[model samples]
Target: MTKTIRTNPLFELYIENNILVINNGEDLKNNGHIKTADIESIEFIRELNFWNKILEVTFGLIVSVKSEYVRIRFKDGFKDLLVTNCDRKKVEYLVYDVNLLILKTQNHHY
Candidate 1:
């Protein structure tokens, strides 16, 4: 049986073992689950301010950020690719996480 779980702005969707986990709370615990097929689509989080810098350094190229199945384009040419399935707050957290990732990568390189 398939059911659609109520999604929230702060939560993220993850699959473990054979069950889908909805992570919203601070503990990173699975609050709920639903069939994978029940998900209509995924909207990725975006870091616009970060991309602005990336754009200036890498001019003439399109930059995108991917989270789960969602892809966010920082350029006008890719705006049409934004996904509507994700809630804004949840996407915001995901974007913040991405920023942290970039920082970690930079630190490691240095």
Candidate 2:
């Protein structure tokens, strides 16, 4: 399955055939593919500041576009975002599925 992670104007990230596909949003420099074999791990983040976190817990709500992010970290210590400005809960599952693909790919499971 091909899952689109994010499609912001700066960059886009997706998973296709178990590979991380970087479709540079509207630009042309960042398009590329990352195999599971090349990465150390993937990380999902709720990029909220102190006030945002407080607001979320206090109000039982979150700002989707401001709080969601996914980070793809390579073995080389460089990190790339799977794009930003994401929706809450939705992007969480996408990140989870991407990690599953990473596991399968790294394990040579097809």
The candidate that wins on TM-score is: 2
User: Compared to the true structure, candidate 1 yields what TM-score?
Assistant: 0.30
Each prediction's Cα lDDT score?
A: 0.42, 0.64
**lDDT measured at residue 18 in model 1 versus the true structure, 0 to 100:** 32
Per-prediction TM-score to the true structure, in the order listed: 0.30, 0.66
Positional deviation of residue 59's Cα in model 1 after best superposition, in angstroms: 34
lDDT of 2 at 104: 75
Which numbered prediction scores highest in lDDT against the true structure?
Answer: 2
The local lDDT score (0 to 100) that residue 99 gets in candidate 2 is: 76
The list of candidate 1 runs beyond 4 A from truth reads 1-81
Model 1 over residues 1-100: C-alpha lDDT tens digits? Answer: 1222224444454444434455544334434654433332234544445766588468955444443234423323221123234555554455454444
